[model samples]
Target chain A: MVLRRFLPALPPLLAFAGILAIWELLSLYFGLDGLPPPSVALRQVPVILTDPQSLFDIVDSLRRMAIGIVLALVFAIPVGLWMGRSRFAAAFFNPLLSVIYPVPKAALMPIIMLWLGVGDASKILVIFLGVTLPLIYHSYQGSRAVEEKLLWSAAAMGMQPPARLARIVLPAALPEILVGCRTALVLGLITMVTSEMIARQTGIGNLVFQSLEMGIYDTVYAMIVIIGALGFILDVLFERLRGWLVGWAEPAQSIIVGST
Target chain B: MIRFRQKQRSFTFERGFRLERGLALAFAIAASTAGLTAASAQTIPTIRVGWTVPAEDAKYWMMKRPQEFPNLGKKYNVEWVQFQGTAQMVQAMAAGALDCSTQGVLSLAQGAASAGLQTYIVAQHVGEKAPESFSVYWAVKDDSPIKSVKDFKGKTIGLNVLGTGIWGPLAIALKKNGIDPDKDVKLVEAAFPTQEDAIRTGRLDVGVLNQPFAARAEAKGGLRKVFAISEEIPDIVHILEACSKTFVDKNPELAALYVQDLTAGMGKALANRDETLKIVTEIFKAPVAVFDPFYFKTRASSDAPLGSADFARDPGAAANYDGIQKMFKLYYDVGMLPKQLDVKDFKHAKIFAPLKP
Candidate 1:
């Protein structure tokens, strides 16, 4: 049972190891100065883990990303449900969303910085802007796609509007909303790195940029590894949450076609 | 008449083919010779000079037009590399990807801060004297009641960056005024251009601005200078022309000549205003009007010494080594420099003498 539980993680672990092997080979083959290989990263592992400031920077970045995502969810869900369920709400919001959503949120940095002031508010807002649109779009689509037959049956069963929304609309929309949340999670990390670099000087971005300045390229690489590992952990945790939330939404397998 | 008619005559098919073949042979020979010359030229070591973007690399700009450095092209097959910031230039120098840069003192200190930086300053860009020296201003919004650094005890301030040309002196100046550089004031890292907006929006109490940008802010009419960085440190040179140690050690005479070449170009800018503005306008892609106040400020200062007479031309000309040490010590005290480096370890100034007018 333990082996079976562990088996699912083997491929990702092997893939990571394979990438490290390749990185080591590249560093050796190219004789790249400043770009130390995986072994150096391993050596610095103790250093990174022990430094309180470095640990704090990592935690701070993660906290900002989480806050941004939560803010997006909090703001997007109600508006998205309204837009999805009501024609007037959809008409008012959809055009505006379409116009704003396609615009790269990063380009709005100076304006965002001006609006939110500099520090975590600006950085978090940048992430929130990036995360919100997809959440709104997917949640709207998921709610809109709920079956008319179910709505009729619920109406016949004397379900009020609020009851229908809570019991019927929300649960039916969970799978697509989870998909949007997954996408936003990835975007949250990207925007977090970007916003940190632009507005504030105290995150993984600062570490990477400053390390490059100090000619500590190994530290830059090390910070990148930390970012990647954090991203991977977040992805795994998210996927588990997604599975639990929408277990009924399993994808249909493709039919085998050839001689078999 | 017969020769003219023959020259103007249309070619027959036989003659056209023969002529084409003959021309092709000549073209191939000429192309081969040109390619060979180019390949040979590549073997000549180029002095890759780095210049930070958004103007202010006046010496680098001086080299761009022959009016600046007459024989720069003759002495060195020059290539100008553009960097977004001092840190990038320092990295390039450390990697040996760049040879020289007209680096700011903060960036130069940063290069020194790095354990592996192989760069050295050959000459000063501007000596620490009023009018001629670099101008860094601490400004507040016009309506702001905060008078000085003392007023900034609990106030928020804008910095271009923590470790840059602006911050190096700003930090020291703030500390000298009895304010703890770190704890007394809240610091926000914002771009110099946008810091004006920050101050206007009441987001920042004080904004530290570098020249040209500061001039623009002053022109915008709502900000007033509270203090000047140069006033705080009268002897601090703002910028220096620096080259890699590898370049200097191997070609000592070349390095000296490089400084001389730069001085000749930059010296012209110091002596003549209108002509220099014309060139500056072109190099910066800015208008003469924008440079009017900036030029006026520079002229009023009236201490533009084209050649810095402050330090020895070369480390061998060690008559004024103490001055150099004092400069290094100032940066160290300011905490701009991370390492407690000895001046002698890096100061080999005797190799680069300023070009005499």
Candidate 2:
């Protein structure tokens, strides 16, 4: 029974190990200076973590990302839900969102910095813009799929419109909203790195580029490993939260496909 | 029932219209207040300058050692913006987001010829000094059999980009050596930081390096230099400090003060190498070891006395119009520029006039 309790974690661990093995084999076979092997890269991970400045930059980046994600969630969910419920709201916002969706959020960094100086505000704003679209999209999907009969029943029971949206639609749509949040989390990290690279300010992205500029290949790869690990950990924790929040809902069909 | 549904739809439309109008009014009020605040705060004109490489650009030092530049925050305030590359800086300038920036001659020509951006060459940032100064280096693995430029034929070459400062000189060198740059060699775009590793790993037969990267590669000591860019284009103006003509014309006094402060700051920084390196280290957040060997090395020629400390920037000296003209012509010849530009037309003579003795 104890073994069974821990069994669910085994596949991911095995898969991660398999990936490392493949990476090591490839790096050794290529023997390229630009492409350091996993062992060499992993050794530098501790060095990076130990460096106070690098650690601070990374933590600062995470702080900006968290704030951006929270801001996006606060703003995007209501707009998305309103659009899902009212045709007018959807019509009014769809065109604007469509225009913005195609533009890479990182590309807006230079223009945004011109308006709002090259500080935390600009970086956080870029991350927020990047994460908002997916959240809005998923929330719209979830809220739109909420049972019409349930909403009608709540209305007959004298529930106000706002109360019905909060208590009924939100919980019903939590699963899809979480999925959107998962995608937004990934996008937020991407935008954070990309904007920092463009701005060349203090952040993990700046550290990565600075290391690249200095020809510190091991440090570059080490940063990659750290970011990848962060993404993996965040995704796993989010999956647990999703399971807890929507345990009553049917389990999503697991498809064997490429990783997100 | 149909009449009642129609009435409900009409009421919803009215509510939506009213909400939209209210939001529009709020946005207008907020925007006007922000504009007013910005206008009130602009006591002194702020020159938004963009820089890429901190170790190379003097603006980085000027901003770091504010005391050395007395004109800063008094005559004009400087707002420094760090960019990833010249391409991004060019975009920022075109967008009117940047007032002044460090630009390569290729980009300067491209900006004027292709984008029609009226940018004036304000001062020289970096240039080659013959026989001693090397602007760029082409290197191969120490064990590679390739000995000279002729051997570069049919071999892969790594460059930071295809048609920037390095490409024109390299093309001239290759063509002079009877190797067609286009048909004979395969040019791959790799970042400067990765070029050393790329060469060492045998991925590239030759990797081009400049300044700090060249210093790092030399310290590592496995790469052999095939040729230097200065050998082909002697005394080539590698980079120039350029500003939009509009900015220079509108605020000539501010522009002049900025140039004076920059020149003075560079002089002071070069005068005290150890202190300057400390500031640079703090700015880059990297070790002083990265820039110690070659950051401010100026070769002693007959014209330029020993310990004169050019540091590849001579803001007080005359603009190298001949060298710049040659570069513009080369860029046009190589199709990097859409049209030929007269170098003299783009020189901000008014701003540099005060520097004349």
lDDT of each candidate versus the true structure:
0.65, 0.76
Model 1 interface RMSD, in angstroms? 33.4
Off by over 4 Å in 1: A1-260, B1-40, B53-58, B67-70, B131-134, B176-178, B296-324
> Model 1 chain A: which ten-residue window has the lowest total lDDT?
A251-260
Per-residue C-alpha lDDT of model 2 across residues B1-357, encoded as one tens digit per residue: 112111111112123333345336535654553343243376888998877764454566677777666678777788776778887778678767788887888887887777788887777667776655645779999899899999999999999977777798888888888999889999999988778878987789999877677777777688888887767777788766788888989988888888777666656666777887888776665667777766677655644322222336553434577999998888777666788889878886566522521
Q: In candidate 1, what are the lDDT values of residues A1-260, reduced to their tens digit?
A: 99999999999899999999999998887544355788886666567668776777677777677777877877886677767899998999989998998888877765665455444677778889999999998889988988877778889999998877656766677677778888999999988887765434356665555454333446667878878878889999889766645544656344444433
Distance from true position, residue A107, model 2, in Å? Answer: 5.0
| CA lDDT, candidate 1, residue B205 | 88
Q: Report, to 2 decimal places, the DockQ of model 1.
A: 0.01
True contacts kept of each: 0.00, 0.21
